[model samples]
Target: MQRSSTEGPSQYPHCLSSGRTQEAHLIRKGEDMENENKKSIKERVALRNSLVKEALAEFLGTFLLILFGVGSVAQTVLSRGSMGDPLTIHIGFTLAVTMAVYVAGGVSGAHINPAVSLAMCVLGRLSLCKFPVYAVCQFLGAFIGAAAVYGLYYDAFLDYTGGVLTVTGPNATAHIFSSYPGKHLSILNGFIDQVIGTGALLLCILAILDNKNKGAPKGIEPLMIGLIIMVIGVSMGLNCGYPVNPARDLGPRLFTAIAGWGTEVFSAGSHWWWIPVAGPLVGGMVGAVIYVLFIELHHVDPQKTPEEENSMKDKYEMIAMS
Candidate 1:
């Protein structure tokens, strides 16, 4: 007897046909979910890796910067015959900051100081969440760098300088390494000088970093930044010690104060202590704001033909796929 098609084999057997189809569909869905999860995990891993790399860059940059700065001061103390010269300190820090920024720019944007980081944050270039981490890393790196300088010149510091770290008389050059005036000046004058000097330095930094204006050649960004620091040091070295960078000033100052300088660290008084920190911070913010207002905000988006836009999209997709 001929059996009906549906009755003989159940047309699509529940277990072997429809059931298998359902199972295959379920498998496909599971695979899609897994792929999405893996993509998310990879993105998170990349982000974390980038952050770690950046933080390390900041630490190393700050370390090198302080090493050069404090090392110069140590040299002055160690050299019995050679007096501490302001010009030497100026040149030393100028070279240090320039080298550090150039070396670390690709990794961490070369923000070796908190003042710069804060300015970037204000300008929306840096995230607020990362500022504290960067600041702490920089401070610790500076402390370690100062220790290295101390070790390098321990004998000289003890014998030639008699372990004294004063900011006056023969050691007046130490102020250039750190921040102090040869003689006490009016607090207001000192504060104003710091503010104006720091402001000018930050302004120069902002100008150099303005990718829109193309103020300098691509490879010359670090050189320009360094030159700006050098000019500030030379022009304002005698006034307020030109601590255009708060971290650069405060970190080494703390080292000097704790290494045995005592309340003499505050010799300029509490009011003066705030000048370096406050001046640079305010100046950086103002500089970034001014840049955003006058330069960055007005950047012209390059006119692109349809082909160019499509080409860009294709390139982006290719990058994503890879």
Candidate 2:
């Protein structure tokens, strides 16, 4: 979680090198083979603290988000206009965001949405090396969650469609997994809607996390974020079903294409599969740049980059150890 300044002139930190130093001292004295055993323990610990852990956390958090969100949609659609309504879905996604953040916030920043991950990377809040890892894990988690939802509602899915899965039939199932723009909206207009919706989502995210800008009272950000998702869902859903997150939409759409929904999942609404993926990434970056220009540009503070801090720590540690 933190880099210490006193690394003692070694590639590893003070704690890591202390054992090596002792081992080297003992080897000269021909004491024992105990130092060899110590080496493996250090390697194991280092591996545990690496990017793999963060990716797993991202995966689990995204899984929670997609599983429940898809489940809510299935419940609403399968009930044939009876069980759950639009509000039910809004609450489901709101809770999904809240619970997913709680699940991964401590470890991976809980960037279950790829849009959020991209925005953070753009803002220098996260390492670029970890971006692809987080994105892949998120997509995989979403895909698996959608698959699980399909399995959970297997009976209902078959009953509703008579075992024939079609995008625009009496038993349409694709919409439950991926979004489709309303009939009244043009493709270009739908794309614009996605841009605006995701842009707004990212803008609010930046505003809420800005400490200098009176960010959300700590511990309440996740809740407030959920409310934002709910509000966006209700307010901006008329045009394109409000897919503000790429992973939340594309991952499930891909799974549906592979699972049983056929290519119609992709071909639906004029090959509309790519909008959610491309729009959010572009919108997030725009939002980040806008926030920085409006707020960070005004504030004048000398701050060290994380890489700089880590490198400085290495030098200090080496000097101290020497």
Candidate 3:
């Protein structure tokens, strides 16, 4: 989400706003306050943002993200020594993430990845009720996106692999959907790689979004995030394909399992599926907490406004008079 500088104004209002009600609720001697203050179910629901709408935005955004990101891998792998190289894959994902942010940022903060959603929930920036909703929507979107790629590349896939779907070596395409550790890596190395990669991802995102830093260059935070991802891929991706997102890996991996890759999808690389899921969650929290400890928590609070001071005095005087 820009919280953008260049993008004029966001198309939708933020579900979370900073304003608070300032009215006084003076008690009467005989008022039945508890009953009177009780809200109807519909009223309470109306007071909050619609979970349906937020989830829908997340789905559409994540759909676009995986459609481009995973589809690029399919293109690269299926091309087989011709086009769609590693650099192209990086560019594809960078654009994919940027566009996804644009799609969902207005309504749902464009948290196309579950790690981002989990971080927001931990920071109390997003409602706990909506965290699971966002994560589920993202996973579903990724699944559908992978299914689309399979359908689009079916002929090319069979041609490239000679009708066999192998996880490694000649004619292998499993890496198009999920991640695997490098040949020299152990299970622990792969896990640490994921943790560090995802941790870096979150750190970049938090820094870009924090105004206390150099204040992002307007509407380009999304662009910045995408580039951050590309940088991570270029630098840290060799260890395990940098599947910093769980849905990005698991969704497509699950699809491959159903589409013919079978149990091999899960059995490969010491059951590596869980690392992208669990590692990002832990790494994202680590990044957020680091930002708080180093930057946010240390910043001094601004002094109260004169209007606030006057209001406080007036409220106290009114209490004494009563």
Which has the higher lDDT value, candidate number 1 or candidate number 3? 3
In candidate 1, what are the lDDT values of residues 193-245, reduced to their tens digit? 77677678777888887766768888788878878877887787676667777
Q: What digit string (tens of lDDT, one per residue) describes model 3 on residues 13-50?
A: 34223221211223341244655555454466553557
How do the candidates rank by TM-score, highest first?
2, 3, 1
Q: How high is each candidate's TM-score?
A: 0.72, 0.78, 0.77
Report how far off residue 204 is in candidate 3 (Å): 1.2
Error of 2 at 291 (Å): 1.6
CA lDDT, candidate 1, residue 277 = 75
Which one wins on lDDT? 2
Q: Which pairs of residues clash in candidate 2, taking residues 3 or more apart in a chain or in different chains?
A: 5-317, 6-317, 7-317, 8-317, 9-318
* Collision pairs in model 3: 5-218, 6-218, 6-219
Which model is ahead, 2 or 3, in terms of lDDT?
2
Q: Which 10 successive residues of model 1 have the least lDDT summed?
A: 168-177
Sequence-dependent TM-score of model 1: 0.72
Q: Mark the 10 consecutive residues where model 3 has the least summed lDDT.
A: 15-24
